[model samples]
Target chain A: MTDQNGPQLTRIQQRNRERILEGALTAFSANGFRGATIDQIAEEAGLSKPNVLYYFGSKDEIHKTLLTALLDLWLAPMLSLDPDGEPLDEVLRYVSTKLDMSRDFPRESRLFAYEVLQGAPHLSEILGGRLRDLVDETVAVLTGWIDEGRLAKVDPHHLIFSIWALTQHYADFEVQVRAVLGPGHDPYAEAQVFLENLFRRMLAT
Target chain B: MTDQNGPQLTRIQQRNRERILEGALTAFSANGFRGATIDQIAEEAGLSKPNVLYYFGSKDEIHKTLLTALLDLWLAPMLSLDPDGEPLDEVLRYVSTKLDMSRDFPRESRLFAYEVLQGAPHLSEILGGRLRDLVDETVAVLTGWIDEGRLAKVDPHHLIFSIWALTQHYADFEVQVRAVLGPGHDPYAEAQVFLENLFRRMLAT
Candidate 1:
């Protein structure tokens, strides 16, 4: 997709815009939508306030862009759940990808978590449209698997919720997780094995 | 225990203090710690800022009191895990109580979620000491059950973490849960049955 100002933006402008977004992601994930400020985001980006504003127009624009981008990345794993693949294997692969995201992109997980916790005011429309559509499509595929006796009967939606809750827990609540697991504990490794055992038993037809 | 200023407070003072804490829970849960303010808390409590301050020295005092109280409540479910009872029953009962808390006290859940997401700055001490101790004791009981072949062999710590992750997700991400589940859906009712089935199969000896 071409940018609305495609022809006008120089290479430097595009680079600076990406820089500001990276900075905003860090600041917003740490401070939340209400707590984060434009000044703090500018400092994080290593750009002056004027420069930050010149690219993004306002703090809200920067935040909406960051969240929109993050949502796309977050949903890619689920969208990759192929109907042609073995049902349980496909679901487990999706789970693995989600856990990898938690490990590799914790800031993004917390940012989404914070938004959802705050009633999803910033992303309600997107949640209702894109997110809802994706989930509905996935649920249909899971339901078809169950109907063919390819997997055990269960609410596909709730199963999806469980996968999300279980994987994302390691990232969004890292402090509590680390405190409980103690120092030097590897949670992702344990989680991978545990969840596989769980879903295997759960999906055994 | 006496108040720092001595124990001469009237009944009204105690009631007013409780009101302030309740108000703070709503504000803090919605906006998180840094985003919330004394003026907002005071307004939510229907008290003047000076009056709210008179009862609690500062916003920090109010926050500390709220957190300490919530920690006690949060730990109560874990503390109720009985060693002498049927091991699986005890665990399921603990799950039920946690789900009940999520349904009844979602704000408390979000407040804790926010604190943990922010590295648990206000909760680190309690999480490290009180929470760690309780989990250790519970893990021992679970280990005992596994040793006796009364339950399936699993890492007791990871099992406990899964319980927390699964149960709390309903509360911490209520909006997303509701949105996906759609209108007229009773998530708690569905969750209760779903969890029971998952744990029953997982724990079958």
Candidate 2:
């Protein structure tokens, strides 16, 4: 995971790297990057501190590695927003895909949340560069749809933000959600229904 | 602010407490509770550590105090959703008011985000008890509106959660929003219009 074009690692090396990242995700999500330690991450990963360091040069490298990987996963949903598809269906798919990520990759969601909450110290450059470009492209698609009267005219950027905020809230504030929801309620299932109706109603031309 | 029923504090005492809380807000927002320390809070507060201790018995007390205060502020928008008002208008007003809070109280938003992100160790009880009860009451009102055909039928709880998720994103994710929007864009002002239109269209019977 360190070098994009680096030599392929052995099977054992691959498994160990995955384990370390999974452990780092848990530790960093529970404790912010500043509060997390390499020893703690090593313990979480079930590798010795020295062994963990053997894969990554420092804690910063581990964090950056985790974030770099997460950014790609995070970008997948937006990247898949098909510009040539039926506009409403395309957006509904994007919303559902993002919600699925929140449910399936909750740790990744919280880890990213923590990073952004602390001013995105590691993510600022990417947020301005790659992320900005991606949103711009998606916005253009939405604008095209609006121009054709295929979708309602709303601020497309804020529309994307709304999808993100609603979907991620279920994961990021899972405890509060579960507590308020009490027992027996499937929050995500209900949210899926709610969000579909919401975007559908709001986006109908 | 510590003891609500206690004797009133002198003006100087009140100012000192406010200063400490302001500083703690910055520290805790930047660094989660575990990452923060008395010395850091004191340094941020511009008080001696002993002085900080003198005002608040422990770091936990200060954090709890800040949260307690923030909770009241957070609840105000929802609390003010008058049952007698036009249902759609009430909801739109609620969204606009919440967006306003995000603009005026970004630090408080981030502080609360940090606490909740870490599972709200200091706030679990309130989440299940008071917060749950408040939401139940609000949801009841929303359900009543839907039954009366005053508002569009939707999952009232998820509706509230959507409002929260959408509004809070601007504040909690302010840096990312700012970066993506680039310069010269007023995110909150733009958000206010977008949200008002969103809830209005979604909730109209």
Which pairs clash (backbone N, Cα, C closer than 3 Å) in model 1? none
DockQ of 2: 0.82
What DockQ class does candidate 1 belong to? medium
For model 2, residues A109-176, the per-residue Cα lDDT tens digits are 99999999889989999999999999999899899999999999999889989988999999999998
Weakest lDDT window of 10 consecutive positions for candidate 2 chain A: A1-10
lDDT of 2 by residue, B42-71 (tens): 998899999999999999999999899778
Best by lDDT: 2
Residue B91 of model 2: what lDDT?
90
Q: What share of the true interface contacts does candidate 1 keep?
A: 0.72
RMSD (CA, Å), each prediction: 1.9, 1.6
Instruction: Please name the candidate that would achieve the greatest DockQ relative to the true structure.
Output: 2
- The TM-scores that each candidate's chain B achieves against the reference are 0.95, 0.94
